[model samples]
Target: MRYVVQVFASAFRIRKIVNDGEFCILYSDSDPSIDCIYVTDKWILSNQAKPGGYYIAYDNGDSEYVEEDEFKMRATFVDQD
Candidate 1:
């Protein structure tokens, strides 16, 4: 299974997600047609460096807005199995 996590930005900017294990941060700035990032893993960690930044989690092909605090907490449990 794969996952995609995105950090919300007001302007057209690149957001990065930390690669905890099998997942790696992906930047899609090459096309310029679309601005986004992709990830492949069970869980994704959002960029906690920026506070108040909106975060979205995509799992099982579904996306939803996630809280920053909750996002960080989830990242800790990755790769436990």
Candidate 2:
């Protein structure tokens, strides 16, 4: 698995993990006033995540699985793999 970590000129940053051509939002916090997006393999619910899709964890303990297309739109791929 490959990973890309992006840091912006802000109080937070975004980190992503790529596994087998799949992209997941590991962590992201662009605004300090809002809750950050934090998700990992352990946070994925049973059978909730699909192939090419990943979960996004919230501060309230909520999570949502988004598809690959959405991930691409939300994230910026810096390099080719």
Instruction: Give the TM-score of each candidate.
Output: 0.27, 0.32
lDDT of the candidates, in the order given: 0.42, 0.45
Q: What tens digits encode model 1's per-residue C-alpha lDDT throughout 1-81? A: 999986432221224545656655544322354455445544343333222333343444544334456556554332211
Report the number of clashing residue pairs per model: 0, 0
**What's the lDDT for candidate 1?**
0.42
Q: In model 1, what is the error at residue 23, expressed in angstroms?
A: 28
C-alpha RMSD for every candidate: 14.6, 14.2
lDDT of 2 by residue, 1-81 (tens): 999964332222333433432333334333344343434555445435544464444455555666667666666544431
Q: Can you give the lDDT of residue 37 in candidate 2?
A: 42
